[model samples]
Target: MRMKKTTTAAIGAAALLSGLLTLAGAPAAHAADGCNNDNGRTVRTAFGGKGQGFELRVNGSGNSTCAWGRIVGGAPGMHVWVDRSSDGGRTWEPQLGWAEISSGGSIWTEAWRDSNGRLMRACGDSGYNTAITCTTWY
Candidate 1:
């Protein structure tokens, strides 16, 4: 009876550990859950190379005054981001918001507030050594 109880305890411990690891590996929810298209719009789009078959988008909401990046029709491992600038595209910080397609055709980055005269644009790469492409600032 003692041996049976020990085995049962071991199995329970293993199951608990497996559940904890799965939760740790899962992606976290976006911080701007409500800042999506339902509350915003696609401000601009950046098309990649004709053969690359990828488009990067800058999405924003006038009411929320926030922006994010989205990549559509890209293979897994491709990358997308939103860039922000105060002076224009000529000089700006890179990858203000970003996301990678882990196993899907599309993905979007976390939203960022576009206040204080900030300008935003979308950019992406084929993730196979292709050059990065970006859209006009908006």
Candidate 2:
């Protein structure tokens, strides 16, 4: 199966949630709490690829590094975009220009770098809104 580029209707929320999933691993097929909602973007990188990335940590209510993430229960049409590059952040492919939040009243997200300089991001829903936010990448 291929990962299609999808856009959520919620807007800013989508970006936040996408960040959560990327940083926290939302368990698309199974349940994995290993990536639960956490505090402000914490970064940790173990010897994996080239050995230089990190694990993002996020929290709800006030810890946000990106836009549209300072408040909870954002207005309708809230969302975000993502960009990535295998060349070490020099050039990035517009992963998801923008997406919306489907569910969850509150959310938190985190981001970090990997050993190979590959970017890793994650985010999670807190209120459990349930709109099914998605991501799109090239």
lDDT of 2 by residue, 9-94 (tens): 46667888899889786432221234233354433212112221212333332222221112244433344333444675566544
Off by over 4 Å in 2: 1-73, 96-99, 102-115, 119-138
Candidate 1 segments exceeding 4 Å error: 1-38, 50-64
| lDDT for each residue of candidate 1 in 21-113, tens digit (9 for 90 to 100) | 999976443334454444556767777763333333334436456777777777788888777777865777677556788997788777766
Candidate 1 similarity to native, TM-score: 0.63
lDDT of 2: 0.33
- Give per-residue lDDT, candidate 1, residue 64: 50
CA lDDT of every candidate: 0.70, 0.33
lDDT of 1 at 121: 81
| Clashing residue pairs found in predicted model 1 | none
Give the Å error, residue 9, model 1: 39
